[model samples]
Target: MKFNIKNRVTLLVSVWMMSFTMNMLEGVCSIPSSLEVFEHHKNVTGKKWAVLVAGSNGYENYRHQADVCHAYQILKRGGLEDDNIIVFMYDDIAHHPKNPRPGIIINEPNGSNVYDGVPKDYTGEATNAQNFYAVISGNRSALSGGSGKVVDSGPNDTIFIYYSDHGSTGLVSMPEGDDIMANDFMDVLMEKHATNSYKKMVIYLEACESGSMFEGILPNNINIYATTASKASEDSWAFYCPDYGLPPPPEYTTCLGDLYSISWLEDSDKNDMTKETLQQQYQIVRRRTLIGYKDFHSHVMKYGDDKLKNDLLANYIGANPSLDENAYSFEPSTTQTRLVNQRDAHLLHLRLELQMAPEGSKEKLKARQELVDEISHREHVDNTFHLIWDLLRDKNNNSTMMLNVRPPGKPLVDDWDCFRTLIKTYENHCGRLSSYGKKYTRVFANMCNAGIYVEQLKATTSQVSIPLTSSSTQTLDLSSIGSSFPTSATLQELELVTSIDEELLQEYGDELHRFGKVQRVFVVSLKDRSSHMLAMTTSFLKGDYQDELRFFRVHKSDVYESQVAVTKGIGKYDVANGYAEIKVVDKVGFSTKGGKVTNSKFLLFHIYLS
Candidate 1:
């Protein structure tokens, strides 16, 4: 970047300004000046890269040498520094051994052209699989190793684990059975970076049947994404069929080496895209690869059975918090499992059935709600199923996950009195959404802790527990353990949907007092275009605690003209998920358009407990 002094000064100002704003809005109202650590970014550490590759040179390899060449193009693209890169490949005839395909060659105006292939053992036959592995592990002689070096880690790094290989249903093997343990490789990858503090890790796999690799992957601190080839067996043949490359080059089956690789990674037509952009583009191709493979397979089979296909699909995908294909792969013993969730709704079939039973016909409404509440609150617990999937997802695929929720399953149900009486009790104890975000940290912490409680419920019920000797001992109550979990921090913003009712605010206000001191409540009325924003203090909401609360008001003009209410003070922090429940009141306060009011849309409320 050849920047003039003017440009450098502008960047400094921009970075400083944005940092200041973020700190202030997040309630960091004070910052010390003249810290020695503020300057000297030169002291910050650099980064590193990790790469993996496997190649073949039989009939397909003979025809797709362009693929080998493409790998070089990817290495040279963007700002990927040379010292940081590691390349694993089987790009020459010796590694190709039997039959060698001519590899592709790329020339960067300012970069090294790296696809020069070596001679010997030349033929049209595919390379022996052993050479491929040997080449990657650095077992070859001088001038006979990888396209790049072997790198494991760095202070703050960016790792790229890429592959282009041939595969079958569950394995990538050479005709001679030289396949590495796919699961083992994934485990090693994640284990290598167990602490997961890298800036990001990118896994770009180009192989047949590669899509299935998503199973059993666990990431450390990296984001794991792969081409649909991860599931189905796929070849990177440059032109075996008419419908393969991006936009299906009219007559291709195997994806050739140089096409997607060179164009996207190396010579991307979009100059504006950076290394970061290239990483994201990999996702687009990964999904498209899956749909493409499925389509190709379907075209070959000619089977239009939706149910059969869905069952076949269920053979692979799952959400047990582990490998989907593994858990859902097996049919549950009972018909209950099959019929219970056919509609794809979040409702738990057993609980819903009990709920709809006569309010008196079943074991009583209390018993039914207890059962419903248990399942609805599944998010708070970690069950065997969660454990199962976590163990099975391909370690590479789950590296740095961003979704903030328990693995999706039972707790996926909606929260309401229908599920938990505590919800109702808490509301009645406080008021309504009023105590939301104010004491939010405390409130949600208990809710999160409640999840800990449910796990105890399951633990006590586990069949493997040894019976304790009893003389004159009291029976243990598992619920007591449930109450021992942690409390989370308060969220800065808690805007409820416009539909929530305003009248319930007071009750929520009271319930939230459990977390910490209640400060203030900011409610914008949904009823009228001119509805004034209400600032309720602790004294106004809680008659007894009024004396303990401190209140401050800023001029109307001083408040930012934004709907997001910023929480202040030391306890403010982010939550695992949006800990506060969001509801759309049956009324509308504002229309879909931001303008005009009269009908109720919803209200915003947040809660934070200590």
Candidate 2:
């Protein structure tokens, strides 16, 4: 088909050019495009599973349950099915008597009700550490009293877990039972990884010291990513509290949401999941939580697989195509200006209850008593720790050892067993270590780090005798022994011979002789032993000017040989107010015949004031 003169040469060139073009087209078709390779690796068949937990109960802890419910709503809207999501909450907030809106719970001021449609798989007593562990491990047999829903996923599935609660140095609190310890939690995650239960996992934890759950413990190679509301040494703040500028309705008293929780949640609510990466959301949340608040703030921390931060949020949560493009907006100024410390939120709730109760009514009295008890309980916890520290320091001669904090990048304790055993030893002697007491767990960790022995702690704990007031003291029937006694007595006139025991003299000789010669004062009564001897004693010693004006009262009881209940100034003796223990050091030269004393005995009184 070419022209004549150079026809043969032209035809040969045309044929070669056509062959080259055909070979190029064939090569292009043989190799796959970048978009096709990306689609292949996306593995579109993978399913998403989620677990939402609220690890606290009571109206004062309304924010936890509310946070969980809001998270459920987000997952539901993200196209995750109800069957794939498991919810564990105490489920007491929505219908609680203190709830202003009887059937509704909101995460923020003027926010939509998140309480609706939240599954009650684990509620009431079922919301505990055991059940939570079982759920994560997919061990249905280990769970008790719940709907038995667990995160039963395969290797190709993506898992998301969100927990909101009160946390301490190395554990997160549970509603009905033991707390979720950090070591145990990490063990569960490792077991899950070993079993190939999921391809990737993402965790969002909201609690005081939430970062302790994973910091320095979670391995980056485990294919798991976690973001915490606060670092191991800080407190997470609560938002929309009663006194805050962005408070909820006037009828509401408790906080509406936690600061870090609401930041990520509201960000998710407004942003397009497909267009956002987890790292982007974490940055947004961290900024919002740290800024716009002058009084309180917490560091939003991330741990584990840093590479996972690059993945799209839609891979785990999913996206809503119905939302407009402009929905991807965030405003730090819109965030609440006032925030409350998570631990003190309950105090605010109690104070509100006391303030709102009707004046002079039984409700008001009950509220007032409850407030008083709460304050007293906190004082008791503080005092107990202080006493424990004092005793430990006396032995070790280290004043600041118990309160020392480990530097960053180091674990809470080198030996987890020692830390746990010390806590058990303290609890065994002192009583239940309540949520308020959990803050002292770092002290236990420090002791473990310092190589403190459990036996030493036990011995120190035994020596710490908590002061017992009338309400905490046990009742004793002293009616039979009080009939044979004088109505009034003075320490100077009532000269009774007594000898100090050699052991007590050796231990407390200086303290005992500091007041002068040991003098005996006794008073007995059948009725009202604590108050009857109020007017009996006028002075402690006759000659010693330092002890002359000091007043004292002896509370006689059949339970012991002799006990003194002394007051400092001249006032009515109220046993309910205070008392001192008088230990019997020795009993010498006493002879009893036919239930009557035949000979005088030298009785020693060891005075120990608390």
Candidate 3:
């Protein structure tokens, strides 16, 4: 204890040497040698398994399948075996009639074909939520179709999952069957963790509002890491669209890939994975996704097990041993320059189809009709939701909250069952919730948060009704109107009929002649429907007159039916406006058999023109 400083230093060195010798002999030490570290790394034994899914089908949704196929190519190049990779795609893009290059799919403009050698483990109707869950849970017996290949991994395995498709708040759509709910998906992951199915897992989800899947719900303690294309309330964009500078071939009208998807895939393609960490890749991807577009971009979000960010990408996706770190580099300029919102991409496809079809041909006619129907359906969905909100407000006297966005780290709803039941109740009363309509799910969540009862929703929805369009089997019943000719009918009188049938002018024929040679009859249906002077150009039309008159339709009111300005006319008729007094003049009948409209009835009205 009284030794000098020099003697103490000598004694400490001798003690350290003795401890080091004992550690070396026992094969354990606080700091290992380089050779020992290399041996430890080499002894790390685990299989890398991946599940790639494209949750949508059709030529318009080509980007999803293309993304999945390109991911497969990357995984394969990274050294993962085919057996360890399970793919679930609708598999309708390659040989589709709209495909410019049959049996070939490309992820970028003039890019190499990614469709080749892609496995069809699940295709067509087999690409569904049930099969997706079964595959992830490794419950092969639960699978109904496809190859029945599941992610049968052990505790030492590393799992990677990539999904690209249309998503809404708290749900991701599948090509067939029900959508995969966030709660249900998390339940499966929790089960996997509870059973010690894997050492670690990573998920890359690309879709609109994909962040909703993991936000506030995924426990960070689980050995799972997730990255989403967008936050819980926004849309992920589609890149390489026909309008972009680096678009697909001239023959292709749809986008080739999604912005978030191509950012990561291209990064993987041009990087040495063994030298890159998950955090680095995520930063690069997030930056590229935001910088690639000028107007539209998504917030790439990461969730769960933050510590896993330090893990090498090679742990989940095998590394390319042949790749030299210096040979590959990530270039920000390589990202897409233009992006289209995923929801609006379908309109681009439809518009392109209409433009390409020969004018006056049946193809052009069909294309035009389809374009009209799509526009109408969108408007109808908007009106339906608005009506639902109005009804809810009337019942609860609450402030408007349908469009409210939850704060970050907050789940869509506190009660998943309430959210799901409300959606079902809405669909049961209204028609099926189309992909576009899925955006209104936030409204449902808001309602659930407000403690809006399902019975109240059912009652409110039952009172709501959507008008039948040209796509519906019901046709207008004009035969009920007596042949009595009113000298002239004001546009005000016709507005009621317009509300009942927006396509009246297009469907009307000789029946109009019975009313007499009409002067300028400015018949305006839904305000945004069209601007063409359809009535003047009809075969039965005769004379032209002055004084353009415009009128608005009246929506049903449980409280009171007050005359409201439904819409304004375009051009000259804009200034000239009037109000129509709605009075049910006659009643028609409707008969239905086997859910098909056998015969239908409609309200008839009569009014005199100035």
For all candidates in order, the CA lDDT equals 0.31, 0.72, 0.73
Candidate 1, residues 1-610, lDDT tens digits: the string is 2344356457446656766777899988554231211222212434435443544443333223444344434344423444444444334432332222234322222223345532222122223444433333333442232232435354364455555554432234332323433443454455445555443445555444344344324332234433333333233322222222232232221222322333233323232231223334444343322233332321011111111211110011100111112111111122211111101112232333344345556454454444434332331122222331232223224422211223312121122222233323323332222111111212222333333232332332231112122223122222332221112111211332222212222212112123233344433433443333433223223344433222112112122221212222221222211112222222212222353322322222233333
Candidate 3 global TM-score: 0.74
In the range 1-610, model 2's lDDT, one tens digit per residue, is 1243265346445555655666688784243332332233345547788999999999999999999998998888877888889999988899998898999999887788899888899999999999989999999999999998899989999999999989999999998878898999999999999999999999999998888888789999989999999999899998889877678887997998998998888888887776688999999999877875755788999999987887778778766444534332445565436778899998888788877777779987687656655664675567567766876777788766566767777788888888878988987776657767788888898888776899998866655532232222223233332322233444323333222222122112111123333333332232564422312222233343234212244433323344444344322222222333333221212223465432122223334333
Which TM-score value belongs to model 2?
0.73
**What TM-score, over all chains together, does every model reach?**
0.33, 0.73, 0.74
As a whole number from 0 to 100, the lDDT of residue 595 in candidate 2 is 51
Per-residue error at 232 for model 3, in Å? Answer: 0.7
lDDT of 3 by residue, 1-610 (tens): 2244355357446656665787989997755442343223434657789999999998999999999999999888877889989999999999999898999999988688999899999999999999999999999999998997899999998899999999999999998988999999999999999999999999999999999999999999988999999999999999888866568888998999998998888778877776688999999989977765656688999999987887778778777545433222334455436668898898788778877777679987787666656665676678667867887887788764487888899888999999999988887766667778898888998999887999998866655543333221221223332232222334434432222322222212211113222223233333543321112211122233232333333233121212322123323444433333332211122223364321111221222232
lDDT: worst 10-residue window of model 1 = 310-319
Q: How badly does each model clash, as a count of residue pairs?
A: 99, 0, 0
Q: Give candidate 1 regions above 4 Å deviation.
A: 1-45, 50-52, 62-65, 93-148, 174-177, 195-199, 219-255, 258-271, 275-283, 286-610
Model 2 misplacement above 4 A: 1-45, 322-336, 465-610
Task: Please name the candidate that would achieve the greatest lDDT relative to the true structure.
Answer: 3
Q: For model 3, what is the C-alpha lDDT against the true structure? A: 0.73
lDDT of 1 at 275: 20
Which candidate ranks first by TM-score, i.e. highest?
A: 3
